[model samples]
Target: MSLRWKISATVAAVSVVVAVALSLIVHLAYARKQADDAHRLQAERIQLLLREYHRGSQPAFGSRLDDPAVPADLRAAVRGGKVATALRQTSEGTFIWAAAGTGDHVLSLRSDYRDSLGDLAALDRVLLLGSAAVVAGGTLAGIAIGARLSDRLRRAATAARHVSAGDPTVRVGAAIGGRSHDEATELAHAVDAMAGALQARLEAERRVTADIAHELRTPLTGLTTAAELLPPGRMTDIVQERTKALRALVEDVLEVARLDTATERPALSDVALGEFTTHRAAALAPDARVVVRVGTVVATDPRRLERILANLLTNATRHGRPPITVVVDGPRVTVRDRGPGFPGHLLRDGPARFRKGGDRTTPGHGLGLTIAAGQAAVLGARLTFANPREGGALATLDLAPAAGGEPSP
Candidate 1:
């Protein structure tokens, strides 16, 4: 059940218990008071009868001489020179019987209490209705309070989700709606504070990375030129290959930092989706298969799209078994490789730079997907990764949002 419903149920249960308890107390007290008053009246009537009998005069009402209608227990007790009373439920109705001993004769007086019993029944009905009203009122109040609290919590939860999705700018703030010092308000403030702190730390890390990449670029250029000048031999070939790899790594670091800082702007242009994807995949991996199901035109940043595709293609070639397949349909491009798909952590957390799996056989750092996702964001596109049930890693790049509309296929 939802938090709102749970809270409402709890309040309703408590209200019902309290109302029942109060009704029971009121009913018992009223019944006891009425019984006590009836007993007192019976005692006074018995005394009046005894006085009349002693003065040699007959009492007018409720006076019985040797009444056989009295209960055997009451008759036996009263004959011992004592005044006693008993209640009996007979076919006539409920009645109170009181008797006293009078010179080998029993004097008795009984009052019909059925009317008072009816009054008690009416009071019980009133108390039951009142209890129902109290429960209903309490349930309604609980619903209102639960709705207010649950709404605030829902908004806070949404803001937390946005932060987890890498947008630290989203804040719950005072829009959550509650007293300034209330727990909900304080929770909103805490979420905003956490987002702010995260953004600060991310900015600091991005600045340091960008600075380091920029500093390495100049020396890498000189190193590339020096390696090219060496004699054509095995040793020179190794040096040039190593130099190229190092340069690529430095460039990737710089690219990721730029993506993180949101410094690169997408240069939108008209591109033929099928032709572009086919050509890029063939150039990157000549042995890979390129399939075009339909032809369409789309407007997007070609440079960024190429970078995203290149990273996906490179990751597939390095970590997966080929032949890779690149499929283009409308504004969507999908790259698939027959391999041990992606890891569970990658699927769960999306992509993070520098977070490579434990497989040392793979020949690149884990920035490929991160860079692809970042470039997709810059181009206003959606990129997703998954391990297909058919047993392969699949990367899909959807450019529909950025393309505005797919041109006629």
Candidate 2:
């Protein structure tokens, strides 16, 4: 159930319980008071009748001498020279009788308590209507209060989602005025503050990385030119190779910074996965096996798709054992390597820049999978890495949202 209904239901339940308890107490007290008054009035009438009998005057209508309507126990008590009273339930209703002995005659008076009982029943009806009103009012009030609270929380959660999606400028904007002290308002303020902090930190890091790569580019170009000018020798070849590796590292860093800014847009095109993977595998890793279980065509950026695929293939070849396999199965491509698989942390948290997976002695910098994931995001595809239960590492890229195909197997 939603928060609104839960709160409303809780309030309604409590109101019902409280109303029942109060109604029972009031009803019982009123019934007791009515009963006591009826007995007292009947006793007073019996006293007046005794006085009338002693004065040798006729008794009142409700009072009688030797009345057979009175209970035998009450008459016996009166005949014993004592005043007594008894209550009886009859076909008409409940009756109260009081008797006293006087001059060898018993004077008795009886009164029915039916009218007072009718009053109590009316009072019970009134209480039922009033309690119902109270419960209905409480439930409506609870619904209103719950709606307000749930709305505030919903807006805060939306802003948090925007922040998670990399729009650090998004703010909940609920912290305002006297209500700022409330829990919902406080949560909004916290989300805004967290987004702001993340924006500042990420901006600073990207700026530094971009600046360093730009500065290294000029020196790297000059170093490459100088090594090429040297005489053809083993030492010269070694210098050229190392300088080339350094230049590639600088370019990767620059690409990462660009992706972080999210300014790169995909150039979409229609491409067939079977033909594309076959060509890419041959060019990138000739020894890697390629299998197409289905023929699928997708609308996506071919260059970005190639970049993502290149990274996965390269990572597998460099860090995993031979017999790497790329399988295309209807809108999905999976690359697997028969090696020790990805590191535990890498699979758990995805890829991170400069945080190399597997053996630390691997030659390439750790930005390959990170770049691949960024490119996949740009193309609106999902790229996930895992170590399948049957040995090696697996990377699956799903482009189902933009794909059309018929599975062959």
Give the whole-model CA lDDT for all candidates, comma-separated: 0.86, 0.86
Q: 1-409 in candidate 1: lDDT tens per residue?
A: 8889998999999999999999999999999898888888888888888888778756547688788898999999987678988778899988888888877888888889998799999999999999999999999999988988898899888878877767655788745766657888887888788788888999999999989999999999999999999999999999999999889889999989988876578888878888888888888888789889876777788888989989999898888888799988878889999988888888998997878766966777788999999999998889988999999899999885334555555
Poorest stretch of ten by lDDT in candidate 2: 400-409
Clash totals for all candidate models: 0, 0
Poorly placed runs, candidate 1 (over 4 Å): 56-59, 262-272, 294-299, 329-331, 401-409
Instruction: Give the per-residue lDDT digits (tens) of candidate 2, residues 157-235.
Output: 8878877878655678642223546877777777788788888899899999999999999999999999999999999
- Sliding window of 10 residues with minimal summed lDDT for model 1: 400-409
Clashing pairs in 2: none
Give TM per candidate.
Answer: 0.90, 0.84
User: Model 2, which residues run further than 4 Å from truth?
Assistant: 57-60, 63-94, 97-108, 174-182, 232-234, 400-409
Tell how far residue 57 is off in model 1, in angstroms: 6.8
